[model samples]
Target: MSSEIAKYVSECFIKPKYEVQEAKQPYYLAPMDLGMLFAHYIQQGLLFAKPSNLGDEQFSIHKLLQSLKDSLSLTLVHFYPLAGQLTSLMDEAGQKCLVYVDCNKGPGARFIHATLDMTISDILLPTDVPEVVQSFFDHEGAVNYDGHYMSLLTIKVTELLDGVFIGCSMNHALGDGTSYWHFWNVWSEIHRAKAGESVPVSRMPIHNRWFPDGYGPAIYLPLIQPDDFISLQEKPDQLRVRIFHFSSDSIAKLKAKANEEHNHNNTSSEISSFQALSALYWRSIIRALNLAHDQVTNCRLTTNNRHRLNPPLPQEYFGNCIGALKTTTTVGELLEHNLGWAASLLHQSVTNYGDKVVRDFIHRWLHSPAVFKLDVLTDCYSVMMGSSPRFDMYGNEFGLGKAVAVRRGYANKFVGKVTSYPGVEGGGSVDLEICLPPHSMEALESDEDFMNVVSLPLKG
Candidate 1:
């Protein structure tokens, strides 16, 4: 074993805690035709790291799969031939299912292998990107596919080719970004446990049938018509995802200036450092589009609903425990203000999605026959989310070293993908990654004012 692997062995060990919740059958309440939407995403498995050098002894995926054989099961959830219902599963009950393949197994390794027998591009990775320790961000693979919700890039890690790209392809029904990471944590933990290492406790499972009171699924979500359901259409337009880094000093200066400006607006409370950065990007985007600064749009946050809703969900209740915190503003309004002032407006929108409101909203939306699609939030040109603690690149251990690159992507349905990070500086540093139309990206990169704020060095 490599010295790095030795360290993992020396570290303290804790019994693995796997929390299992009854998987609910979502078929009953979910719109029948909506299965097509699920099909769209599930078919495309998430792409994670594509590590090179499968020959590595410690971190090789092939070896890792061998280790997993004793602890996990791989199989498919096949639909019946006659009934055509997803009535039968191919694995033993309570056994976790994962699939492994090579070029000759079936199709190319680029396709995701899942227990459900779905061949979605939901999970895939390109092997060319640099490793986490070298680049810290895989610029090419960290992206969501068209019509899909999240970017799932799978990188292969082997001694011969030592690069790894890690990511997931998740459906909105399974949960938002928060739930996606939660699942990763568990997968990692289980892998570690089987390797004779210790992992933190796992979160509880959410049965597919489980339904909370509120909304029934509105109009079929995947937007598939009756005839279109059976036959898939051409691949939807793809969303472009990119990652950009910023420095701590630059973020602080921007926040200070924003605060000074907010004082003029008669706002007493301070805005978060994130709000300050968001305002700048918002303006840059507007400038890129040549749209009026005052054009009204919404900025959404994926609020953690674990604590807010009625009968707070258990810490183990791991699924899509998230709802959007929406804020409406004009490009002019956001650009006209400083960070502090912009932050206040952003905060107000977030505060609106409290426990009571979120529960009620979920109940109402799910109960309605017409499913509320992305259109409600997409009308606005941009949607931004910030302060994700779960995106901890340093914590993930594929054994080479820390991840060199970590970034977000656009899901194609929306025009924008903006995510901010706490700065590397001890004080308050922020990093923002925005995915926009290729033309919009070019326009923003050229803006003098936008460049002034974001100008910073790479984290390492």
Candidate 2:
């Protein structure tokens, strides 16, 4: 909250608009194995853009709002579940349980209209994530599946001096990042299509929860108990959110170095750009913290199982198809090992995620209730990384130009979370949005190894 940002907060208004639900029948989405794990969380992001290149002839506040509202309705035809809400209901056995989404009671997604007295450049051009940028999002409280069922998605349209900002808030229990982006892409396509232009055949989403043969429906009935869920509210502390850019060339160099070091031990497996970058960050953070030699450290990499499933899910499969692959080592081992060693650890974890492994995970969840009580933040020395460099973040164009910058609205809340996105400048560059405590972030800023490859564009 800086004085500069406060100046632009003079005028703002929120108008809620609801669309008509297109789906007729009541759709009961029992939490899929993956969905149940994230039943209490939400995913949010903001897409910033300058005014549409079409000028006033095609792009105006009124036109933009109408297009968004209409296209969202059309998009709901394919993503109907998003227009619904999550609820806790009693099963035939009289057992209370939570459903991922209840489409029977539908009010559609929330469409908000807002105006800001600022320009897009004032936000996007900054190297760091600007606090004021968050104002564009709908500040609705956290989702409560046990209580009142609210909209699964909300979109906020903010008019800036030179552009418009589209902010999206989605319930994680309904879907994952892939589903979120899929809905956005389809909505954008429908918005850009001309009156006579036929809407492209959208890849229909698959909702059936996958299970191995012989598993009874009761196994997935209630994946979480009332005492197992944790509040989505963030811990109270000051965290520094910084965006670090790594160019294609830098990533390539890091990959080459990792491969060279790994080959020295005669291992045929090579590290990917993602593994290399992640390893680098892990090492940098450990060095910055200067932890004790015996301190245990771990990395939790979010792995998508859509393709890794036994038969592979449909390309259009929605909902949570994600799992975490974790690797652990003592602080001393990490500090003593070369970059390749750390990268190989990550590479091996990903390579080990085969069909059987995923199935085993489901079986464990079915039998074990303690898994639901596991706290992600219980381990202080762990870092959780998510998102992918391959996500088409810049491809979202709603009859306007491509987004100049893409950012997550809630990433700053997780203390040791790191999310990666394709750089706004395009090419093979990567931008990592990292959230860390003030001391850890300050240490990272001064870490020579990290500074060598990361470009801190905002720092003087």
TM-score of each: 0.63, 0.87
lDDT of 2: 0.68
lDDT of 1 by residue, 126-203 (tens): 211111212111112222112221222222222213333433333333344454454545555455555443344445
Instruction: Write candidate 2's Cα lDDT for 1-460 as tens digits.
Output: 3343312222222222233243444444422433444343444554555554564475578877777777777677678777766555566676535354556455567777777777766776664677776666653335334323556677877777777778887776667778778878777777777443336645666766565677643333444564444454433366678888888888899999989987888988879989999999988887777789899999888778889987898757777777878889999999899899999988998888788888887767656432232355335576778878787778878866767777666522566778888887768889888887788889998888888898644221
Clashing pairs in 2: none
By summed lDDT, the worst window of 10 consecutive residues in model 1 runs over 74-83
Minimum summed lDDT over a 10-residue window in model 2 is located at 6-15
Q: Candidate 2, which segments miss by more than 4 Å at Cα?
A: 2-42, 52-58, 92-95, 98-100, 125-127, 139-141, 144-148, 196-198, 216-231, 234-236, 369-374, 456-460
- TM for candidate 1 is 0.63
Q: What's the residue-level lDDT of 133 in candidate 2?
A: 62
